[model samples]
Target: MNKKGQLIVVSGPSGVGKGTVLKEYLASRDQIAYSVSATTRSPRPGEEHGVHYFFLSREEFEQTVQSGGMLEYASYNNNYYGTPKKPVEEQRAKGNDVVLEIEVQGALQVKKACPDALLIFIAPPSFEELASRLTGRQTEDSKTVENRLNIARKELLCAKEYDYIIVNDTVELAVQRLAQVISANRYSIKNMKEFLDEVNKHA
Candidate 1:
């Protein structure tokens, strides 16, 4: 029988380099599956439906949430974002670890829905560094950057709720730590039921 895959949820405040870390991690790990979230917001340039996000109408998104198709969801900037339950389950059924890169609220929701889910929080090396990174992006206006920093403060407070906390001082180091977490989980007692059963059978 194929070993069940793990549901690993990665979350962090904006500008903490979570995306860069996960991008490198996914590129290095072929066996891992990246969970694409569904959103009611319009796709940005170079983004594709079903690839970057499963873009849906507000009504469609709400209906899916109502029907329990979403494993976890949240409203941000007046748009809805959520993880679709089917794809995650499908990937796990094939023995592929599924990674969910989401916000803190959605991560908390996942924890409640799937108690075994591994939650990891990424954090910046320092508050000053985080502020610098947010400004460095130059993607958002100053006001927006300030807003994100405020939100980051709150998100940081929830770091204690995660199973692991990774400090994103460097992309390489963060990816290494994230990889170690996944590797360690593979050998966890909860994931080794089949192996234990086999050993008992021979004994």
Candidate 2:
């Protein structure tokens, strides 16, 4: 079957180990990419441009939005972030699975745009673990941490919308699960039925 490459949409709340899970998956796996999101926020100490995020200025980000360059855009805490569409399409065209590590809103939008894409949610084993992960980072203030916790609860509620919900107890395990999901999705009958049916026309 000549099927297009899969777009795996990974979504979860803050501090859910989603980033860690994806990073580990990337390190071990071949033929896939972790898409870089475009954001107005400044890069942190270790982040690289076009790797962690596009790190655009507010004007450039807004220009992309106005020009329809973004596949999906979301505003949180008054700043803007979006997924640039062209590069993702280009990657997928090369038969590589393009993983979009997006939040729930952008995930849903991708789901609508390409229903064939796989959607997975990475959740912590418990709320406490999630909270610890957030606070343990020591990146945000107490008030910001509190706000994230509040949002986390709400994001968890959308778990039912995804294809699979995998609790990330450890990075290795989560990456393994993600690999399994990708392997299984590649052979899903929905993506192969057309080819099978057409070839059996003489019968």
Candidate 3:
């Protein structure tokens, strides 16, 4: 029988390079599924439905949330974002670790729903550095950047709520740390039940 996979939920402030680190981590691993969230927001350039996110109309998104299709969800910037329940369960059943990159609100909700879920919070090396990164993006206006910074401050406060905190000083280092966490969990006694049972039968 296949060992059940882990459910990992990652939360971090915007522009902290969570995406860069996670992208590299996924590139270097196998049997790790990234949970694509559903959103009511319009897709950005180069973003595809079912790839970047499961884009849905506002009505459809609300209907799913009401009918229990979402595992966790929250509204941000006037748009709804959420993890779909079925895909995550399917990936876990197939012995593939599932990673959910979401906001703090959604992450907390997930923790309540799945007590075994590993919650990791990625943080910037410093608030100043975080500000620099946000402004450096140049994608959004200064006003938007400032808004993100304000939200980030609140998000950082919630870092203490996570099971682990990873300061993303560098993409390479962050990815390495993430790998270490997953490796440690893979060998944890709870995850090693199949091996333990086999040894018990032999004894």
Candidate 4:
């Protein structure tokens, strides 16, 4: 039998730099595919629909959620964000490991939906550093930034629930850790079951 791909869930607080780490890590991983999520939030300056995110309206996003098209979803900052079921399954079925860079809520939901999925949390070196990064971005207003910081505190409490937690002290180091985690998981007992079974039979 052909080897099946694994579902990787990379989650963290808002300003943890998970996206930057993932981007660098995935650059050298040809067999891994990044799962694009659908969101009700408006695109940032350089973001494009179907590229950065699906960029759906509230009604469209709710319709997908209601129809069970979303594998997992959560309301964050008054906007809906979710993983589309089809694309992820399709990529995994094709033997391409799929990674979902999502928030804590959606990551938990995915864990329930796909028990075999690998849950990795990215954490900031310190809460103060996280605050600095958020403020440095200048993307949102002061009120919004405070709201995110509040949410980040709560999200940090759930990091222990994840299978692995990597601190984003430096983007390069975080990328290295992420790659190592994925490589190790690929050969884990659970992920290698089919291959192991075949080997046992041959033996």
lDDT of each: 0.91, 0.87, 0.92, 0.92
TM-score of each: 0.92, 0.93, 0.92, 0.96
Q: Which window of 10 residues has the lowest lDDT sum in candidate 4?
A: 1-10
Report model 2's TM-score to 2 decimal places.
Answer: 0.93
> Clashing residue pairs, candidate 1?
none
Report the C-alpha displacement of residue 69, candidate 3, in angstroms: 0.5
Query: Model 2: clashing residue pairs?
Result: none
Q: Write the per-residue lDDT of candidate 3 for residues 94-187, one digit (tens) a residue.
A: 9899999999999999989997788999999999999999999788899889888998999999999998999999999999999999888778
* RMSD (Å) of each candidate, 1 decimal: 1.8, 1.5, 2.0, 1.3
For lDDT, candidate 1 versus 2, the one ahead is 1
Which of candidates 1 and 2 reaches a greater TM-score? 2
Task: Report the lDDT tens digits of candidate 2 across residue range 10-66.
Answer: 999988888888888888778887789998887878999988999998999999999
The list of candidate 2 runs beyond 4 A from truth reads 201-203
lDDT of 4 by residue, 1-203 (tens): 43778899999989889989999998877888999999999899999999999999999998998998999999998998999999999999999999999889999999898988999999999999999999999999999999999999999999998999999999999998888898898888788788788999989
Candidate 4 TM-score to native = 0.96
Name the better of 1 and 3 by lDDT.
3
* lDDT ranking, high to low: 4, 3, 1, 2
